[model samples]
Target: MDYGIWNVIELLGALGFFIYGMKVMSEGIQKAAGDNLRSILGTMTSNRYTGVLTGFLITAIVQSSSATTVMTVSFVNAGLISLVESAGVMMGANIGTTITGWLVSLIGFKMKISAYALPLIAVAMPLMFSKKPNLKNWSEFMIGFALLFLGLEALKEAVPEIQKSPELLSFLTQFNDPGILTRLMFVGVGTILTIVVQSSSAAMAVTIVLCAQGLPIEIGTAMILGENIGTTITAELAALVGNVHAKRSAKIHSLFNIIGVTWMVIMLPYVLDLLHYIWPAPETGDPNKFTLALFHTTFNFMNVMLLIWFVPSIVKLATRLVKSKGDEDEEFSLTNINYDAPLTAEVSILSAQKESIKFAEITKLMFTNLKELLNEQKQDTRDKLKAKISKLEVRTDEIEERIADYLVRVSEQQLSIESSVKVRSILSIAHDLERIADIILRMSKDIERGNKQKSIFSEKQNKNIKEIFGLVDLSIEQMITNLNGVYGKVDISGAIETEMAINALKTKMRKQHLKSTEKKEYDVQSGIIYRDLFFAAEKIGDHVINVSEAVRGDFGKDDEDM
Candidate 1:
């Protein structure tokens, strides 16, 4: 055994190089595709079959099934797609992953693509400095594509030939028997290899290169099966931080792969025979790489064909396997955004938008509770309502901070003009919504203070305050609707009209309060409380209208008026 410690390091380094190139390439394509990629995933996954196609297309374009699966998990986590839809996408991702094996065979082995790596880099370097974001993104893709082939060539050279590593060959030769146990063992090897590298594609490449260096195709095929099982771990790990739905979605991927691998392992010998008969391996240079690639593709395609009919069943099983956290499940958490692995800027903006909508709902509840606090007569009940209002205000502040932080991270990335606008809209909306919560909390405190001082609103004062509360409620409802509705399609006029109504009511109440002050209808201290409550409601209306305006992407339009 001439291979030593440095040889192992060299091999690992080559693997690292290959994985790095793949990562850069995947990110470049994702960035370049931008909103168009999001639009595809959003629109095309209407049904199971279309979802499959969508998954395949995205994985192929990005050159990483792990990326596609994680993206799917994030979507499911965010509630953007249902579990059934995620199942379909995961199925398609399995098939899409085989593209890497084919690339390793057809282009990587047969062609000298690495020879042009330098020239590609040369051309990409100048474009990297372009003022146009699109141009810069495409240039990044070019550089990554070049790096990928160069790394692949490095991998091919770094692998030790079996003839040169007789000890390793002798050990591997024991697994050459066409027995089920040997097949299973190699499958385990493949799975471990994939996991160790954290990339099924890289694992597949290693299997191909090893086979090319004289390892039997049967062993190589078994390893490929293991790789299939191993790739699902990435999605599973990604889902760990996600919700129960996310966990279920990742389970679907694992179950699909595990079931496919189980049947394939049983039928491995026969399947290999069939492949050999259909596409005979060439005599020289371990030609079974093509056969292995074909088997990878055919196995996934057949698995999908057989299981697409049982997607509902798969979803049911996944649901059973991963239970929800019950009360915690419905708590206000970041369902849409996964800060652990930030998606593309466009996709992230969509996540932030959903979170903002939830924030709007929280704001609505805070105001609703504030109204309850004012009219709540029982001291115990009022204290509880006040406590709840305070808690909600704190929650709104935390939500604003998190969403803003996530958006700021998204902004740091290269962004399109439209995505940039979206980020700003969500930020402004989140800020205003937080402000509304603050105002509600302050109003609740004022109401509590007046109660402690033996000052209460008269019947007429209560009635007028209720009228203004009704109007503020209307404005909050509209704010929520706008947050959930389409951005450009927001009916700003209705929101503006609501703001005007709130303003008009506030003015009317002011006049009435002054008249009462002159007539001594209520004590000065009570009048001051009434003035504070109505003015706070008016301030809430201002913020509520600001949210709707942000939804319309109309920032700074009525700032002076507000």
Candidate 2:
């Protein structure tokens, strides 16, 4: 049979639709689920076992390992999880991805299931039309699920024509030419195609279709193997713009997949024999779809069982391989970089918490330095403190850019319904953090001016300022440390304490301002200095309140501190 240009075009079109539908569906699911991803992930303990379990559970729900890994990176970037915890999450993601293979196997054989997809689209389209976000998410999920089925049908239709074409069949045969070298070539093609498409499931789907259409099992598995390695590129790409720690996490993903696939390649015959034992060729039956599903599951499960025990060695090897260069501070390393293809819900929450910690630390330090500047009772010391505050302002800008980039990637991770809400929470927290940093910078600048003019506040005013600073400093430290832990159902007491101190300071400062304004005992210069101090103090108080509001999930307007 001479398959013409139109047939190939049809095949391509079907593949396109199938991929598009899957993309749509994954996004919708993520929209539905991503908010909880962050909080769920945030709750993972330092224990690697639990960390891996968290990763596994999230990926299972999202049906995408890339989504899980990406979320892990985001959490890490926000400093929500330690590197070890992130790695465990990545491991769990690998296990979770196996579920898709099972679902595919179960569904692929059903000729009638295609009918369900259309109704799914119909239901989803209406929801998509709704103004509500939840409705839109539901609509998207249906539409996406429908498209996937339709695309599969198209893929099957597109296959038969190509199967009949001698030219196309012959070309494919070159890779299936009963030689190991040819098999490896096919593996390379599969890896490259998946990498290009950025979707292992799509690649897997295509492989299943080919196998269903009577392609050799050996050839299909080779492509699947390639896909495993191909998927790692996403994590690596995520780390490219991220800090060193992120790069490290991505590297581990790549190494883990590559090494596992390599071992599979070396023991190819044994692997095939194992598959054959598990799924013997049906003597009377046509190439059974169940057999295909079995292979996919058994292979992945075996890999997990084999490698899960080797987690320590894998970690050591990956860490040593991606060592940081000298002169590099680990603190600035991309510890929190995420690898999710799109940010999932669980990750968003984790990312938000991480960002809050960083923001809190910066704000606390900013104030502490300001207090020192006020106390400098040494011109040089005051100058150094001033310079540090200016540096901090620049740092806040960097934090925004970095965290925002990570969040955008999180947006891509195909989040879960619950995880999606947490993502929003995280986003809200990040904004509060940036705002807090800005206010702190303003205070820094004010303190700098006072130091330059060799000005001092009245004895009473100085004592009050010192008292306020002491309270804020103590609260911020507790807030940062507690933010990283799980006592939650609620935020750190720091959130409430921050509000209380700020309110007290605002009231006291207002009375002082009234007295100063009425008496006019100070000169014009003194009045100007006094006014700057009052405004700066008020701004700091306002920022702390803004932070508390964010933790409380009150995204209302910033609370003015008197």
Candidate 3:
């Protein structure tokens, strides 16, 4: 009866504390286990079922389904996983999130763990300041674990006892009427609560505390269902900056949860009776939150069981709902990465690697465009090719800048030895790819200028150019294969052979060009263009070798190439 504005402030403060603890704990664990998480997501999602299990394991480890979903969206955006696989993972994440409810119920309500909060902080202090990254990360996790229980304890003290406050009890009871409308209204309440908090786990914590403080079990159950639907908002928001596939993956998460919740709401009364029959509410000590936790787990587990078989159908619906732009060019956009959230060093480096591959692929396209420009006889077609090459060149510059920025951010984090090497290697590879694009654009410009000035090449000179173009294509193809292959597993012997052939061809072209110029076989301007073109192709070959070297983790060691 004495509840006031300060009580509301205390309640809000406790909620913020709980949410912050969840954030810190989740991030700490994720940063510590990032590589393992990447490995799991990459290797285990071969099918829908495996993806679900992968998602559940990851969510359970990190203790937040939102983090798992966001990571899933990132992977989909990177083209690392398929839509059906993502659907399975999202389903698994739903079941995994119920772990938090059970934790709060079994530990927070049944035990006085908050009594150890201060002692836990004291123990973590030394590790928090450790020079080792792993130690420091785990220390943060311990501190977060302590703070979560402390926040829960504060929440218990902040909420007024519903029994003593007859007025408040009367207000809450109005929504506890045994009707479908009552359940639906409470579900809406839970949904709004989760959306406002941006954390289903935190919302579940609040719901558990309320139930413990005399709120009805049925009302809490409805809210838990709403929280399931609410949690999908994280994935949707995460996919906002992603590509079409990422959006579709997120759509499947929303569709799955909404459909599950729809069926559950209709079955709410029967489910409640069954739950009560199975684990009747206790009359004593901190109202039985176990039933609420049980409902949370069973609902999600059953939902996954019912929906796993329909992953393909879910993917189809999502794809139809979120259509790709008709003219979307994967190379022209940074589809593999986003800056919306802070990613661990491992995840960040992986994103940069994928983007760098796209950067290399773009240079290959520019080379093809240059060849097209050289062959086009019509003035209009040549102009168009020139414009296209110029556009791609500009885009390559932008892509390189973005990848550099992303890598720099990744480098700022505490990285393992391998990840640090990868960051540098990706940076070097991106630089070389952008340089190749520059060379291609310059060659295109030279050809355009020659055409404008009526500086026609001799048959022999054209043949040499065609031959060099073919060699360069071979080199670029090898570079891409190296980029796509596992790091440090590349066979640069093929790249070396191609590079040698290119160099030998460039030397031969130079010798023939000198003889032609000496004999006045063509104008000095035409001879100069031929030499420049061959030299540009040779330079691209050099950079392609550099890319292969970087892929093999042998970058910057060879002065001749570097």
Model 2 ranges off by over 4 Å: 122-136, 160-183, 284-289, 323-357, 371-386, 401-432, 445-462, 474-500, 509-535, 551-553, 556-562
Residue by residue across 1-562, what tens digits does model 2's lDDT show?
Answer: 7557998899889989887887677667656664465456655756667877787777776677877776566555445566677767777777777676666666755555587877767767777667667777778777877787788888877876445667766776665434677667767978997887787877787778877776766778778878888878877877766666677777777777787777777676676787778667777644535655666566666676777677777777877877766534255432344434455444354545666676677767777787777767587887788888877777777766666676666666654433444455556656666676676677667766766676667776677666666666666665566555532244646666765776677677768767876786555565566666656665656655555554554542224411
The clash count of every prediction, one per candidate, is: 0, 47, 0
For candidate 3, report its TM-score: 0.83
Comparing 1 and 3 by TM-score, which wins? 3
List all candidate RMSDs to the true structure.
4.6, 5.2, 4.3
Top candidate, metric TM-score: 3
lDDT of 2: 0.67
How big is the positional error of residue 173 in model 3, measured in Å on the Cα after superposition? 4.6
TM-score of 1: 0.81
Q: Is candidate 2 or candidate 3 better by TM-score?
A: 3
Clashing pairs for predicted structure model 3, backbone only:
none
Displacement of the residue 105 alpha carbon in candidate 3, Å: 3.1
Candidate 1 residue-wise lDDT, 1-562, digit = tens: 4778998888888888888888777767777886567566765449889889888888887777887788788767756678899888888888888998898888888879877889999999999888787888788888888887788898888888886777888887876665888888888999999888988999999999888887878899989999999999988888887788888989999999999999988988888788888988677766767888999999999999999999999999999989888955534355335565624555567667767877888788888888888777899999899988898788788778888888899889866555677788888998898898888888988999999998978999989999989989988888887876777557878889989999999999999999999999999999999999999999999989888988887872345423
